[model samples]
Target: MTEQLLPENVQTWAQAPLPTAPPEPTPAGRLTIASVPAGHPYVRGISGADDGVVRLRDPLPDPADPDRWWPPVVLDAAWITQNADVVDVVHVHFGAESLPPGRLAGALDALDAAGLPLVYTAHDLTNPQLADQAPHEADLDLLISRASAVITLTDGAADEIARRWDRTAVVIPHPAIVAEGATPPPGRATGAFTVGVHLRDIRPGIDAVGSVRTLLAGLTDLRAAGVAAAGRVVVNDRVRDSDALDAVAALLTDRPDCVLVRRPRVADPELEQEVADLDVALLPYRHGTHSGWVELCHDLGVPVVGPRVGYAHEQHPDEFTAFEPDDGVSLARAVLAALARGTRPGSGERAALVQRRALARVVQHRAIVRAHTDVYRTVVRRTGASA
Candidate 1:
């Protein structure tokens, strides 16, 4: 998609002059970071207790609803300017989607005025929540251009960043999602294959309805072939009453081969277990870059069937099977191919494997933390010396 021209006001702000005061010196000892929405699973996964980097507690946007952190306060230019003394650097991951181009430019301006180096992890080139890619590309154009350092999860993404923005991004592998020592639930029954598709709130990036239809079709074919197979379509309470839910329900009517399961949003552990139990986890995303869900499935040793949109297959090529987005036949074929590979190890062996994987991830997390720490220190040292 072509980059959208930023609004005139944002352009004007980008060229406008600001205060010329040097930022406060880096705090003694460990570096303090003001991460945008610091509580996200990805951020927590990469952080280590001994990494010598501390992420400030996320500011509550709503006092009554403490969990809501959208429109991250840290991204507010005023907040960055006021609290610039406490943080050595500002690292942004998600939550920029909450701000418009003008406001986001202002935040960059504030970082400049405060002399706080900005480290941005490019988690998504295209925001899945929006159908139009231009708005998100516009955001990327601004953030990537002004960021002091950039990071991405995969080589393909890093290359794309270079091609699109002429910026080099440090390629850091995504850290493990499931915490160590968390036991997954018992595996599903033998001789019966289960395919799962999670339509969490029906975001614009996900082809929820089409994905369900494709899985149902695939299940029908499997049953006809004398294979004992079932399909599970899961949706959260957020889309329980929406037209998307109604459409999905209509498609599943009288279709006993597939069942639609609805429930409230689940915590990370529970969600991990749910994914671990499936024979094949289907990612129904129509567009986006990278995937935490793919990583979750990989952590639990579940094979994934994902759309061929982003670098998800690159994350774990052996564990991922790609399909044409929104194509029922292609998705069905991919599901069959995934199942043909084989089911996960028996419960006893699988648990031991999971433990080993989790233990190894502890080491991986430390390395990821170290990589981030190095990036933070580089920017802070450069800025400090220049100041």
Candidate 2:
């Protein structure tokens, strides 16, 4: 039978067979990463306690300007030409959003010319920044097809890659972001049910108004059913004049139960506190492949009511409740279910439990680092032998 043709943008070799070979020895010594926002919680948490096998750090383009760390120079063909020797291998966690497909292809060609291996963690199958996924899809196809090895956070995402691109990706769960030794928030006060939804500048995939409206309706139902004596839905967003923000402002005028916290932007500590204070947090994403936010909420001992759009529920089934996409009624029902379950356990026992869980999570992260290191070694070795 003749092989069917793929789209112009889809990687041609995605359907190719894998070579059988003995496993390569694990790569050792300082391994640096060129992750977008190298200091992001996800990247930083990968080291887990202090596993010296991976010396992961994002090389700053400008030492003084932290913002310059993004759109990482490692992805530049010219930069890779000069600096491929600086790092043993290039592992791309992110930073493809800003690069055009042509630029990314150039970077891949540079890596090939330099005889340097490339590893990509498929963090976002669909970029939430763009409503239209074509560009991102094309970019992902190119990267996945050319990558030395691919890694993903969830089985669902891995399956999608296999189905769409005919490539198998190693599945690794995202690491917990909460500090291993950090303290968990005190349990909720008696009779108070606090559910939070963050609407930050009305990001593309978030239906902020729809989420808020659902939560408000849910709160009303919970109070009427006597499941909650008192309820408060804390909605945090950057103060902006958008349809979502306007609707929130109008809702605040009519509803005394809702508290709208307006801030220009929430810092890491404050964001963590916002999730820590809630009985349950709602993630209002219309579409996403997975969520580090859900992992963080779990680490903080807060359950998440997330949309069924992606693998948020799979990330932590115990801590996540999924509602149908854009279905206000489903979300309302999920909220009520969370309220009926009551607040998380008290500080003493629960805090101790969380601390133990945090330690386990640290170990999990170390394993992830080790796994990536293994892949790096395999790719570098195979490429070297071929050379």
Candidate 3:
């Protein structure tokens, strides 16, 4: 079959040779998780900082370029070949983020060759709305047949995978990591309402040239509607070209407080603190479900003001004030209202009630690890392979 060409934004990479494996151990009960990128926010939320149920390993570094999810994921060849029995169950974390074609194929093929029981956790694959959906879906189906159990970030995502693959996914949305005893950042005297768009997933079609046009149009309507506020658009990699970014910068150059801070994933915690300092946060997303961005805001107790698309509603906390996607005007209104009448951390009664609600629906860390453990055990049982 001819290889499908990637979008202008995506690219390919060389496949690393599979890792060499040790002889099978009949007496061991270990499981190996094939994480695409270690320390990814999703992984961190799911694994909850590695508590003793399954061994996790990845070829990628802790802080790889967050925006560049395309290809060259840590030499997987060295991984599968070298660390075959590193775990009893071979749970491969697969998603539609981005990767080299041959690299993904090689990883699955190697696992098959090793006679390992495979489990795939689908994060965001099969969403045809994504730019590279065709290839992503093809790879997902190819990998699905080998899956012992499918884990997904949202119930909707799981259902979609099941419908496409004809197999059920164990629904396991990523958990929020509570920052215990941490105080919110100091409020800015003259704040710039922040809208954190981790611009990696944002396509060039909505650049400053285009997105700014949308925002400006929205702002005009918002000002007319008497609900406009001054704020900076916080970004990590919103623009693909420096010139495009410069144009975006120029749009804000006249504003006294408009700022752009190039933040690495490692620096995101501090960045979030800065974002929390703002009165309101915006997603301004065009498409897709299950946002790590929204969850981050909720965990930080930062109120969100985003479009009613994808998983942005997951952050609404209720039915009111959810803005429609791509509407700068409505989004601006949501932001203005939250900023103008500052949100109080729920009063003591509300806080306690919220905690109880959180506890009731809590996705415990142990539960997440145990879910993987069960998948491992099930895979081992099904494959009847020597551990």
Best by TM-score: 1
On a 0 to 1 TM-score scale, where does candidate 3 land against the true structure? 0.72
lDDT score for candidate 2 against the true structure: 0.67
Per residue, candidate 3 scores C-alpha lDDT tens digits across 1-387 of 001122354442333233243434333344445555444555555663444444454443222333432343432455566666554555555433355566667766777677766677775553423555577667777667656677777666766776777888887656654433344343343432344333432343223344554455555565676643445565545334567566766776665434455543435556655654554566555555555566555554556665554443643455224665556666666666655544433334324433543553355656876676666677777877554
Q: TM-score order of candidates, best first?
A: 1, 2, 3
Worst 10-residue lDDT window for candidate 3 reads 1-10
Total backbone collisions for each predicted model: 0, 0, 16
TM-score per candidate, in order? 0.88, 0.84, 0.72
TM-score between candidate 1 and the true structure: 0.88
Q: Compose the digit string of candidate 2's lDDT tens values, residues 299-328.
A: 777777877866778898877777765565
* Tens digits of lDDT, candidate 1, 1-387: 001111223332333333234335544687888788688777888888788877887775554546655566677787788778778888898877666457788889999999899999998998876777887888899889999999999999999999999999999999887665566554655557778888887777878877777777777766776778778888887752388788899999999878888997787666766777788899888788988888787777778897787788888888788877556667667777887664553566556666667788878888898999899999999788222
The global C-alpha lDDT for each of the candidates, from Candidate 1 onward, is: 0.77, 0.67, 0.53
Quote the positional error of residue 96 for candidate 3 in Å.
Answer: 7.3
C-alpha positional error of residue 133 in candidate 3 after TM-score superposition, expressed in Å: 3.2
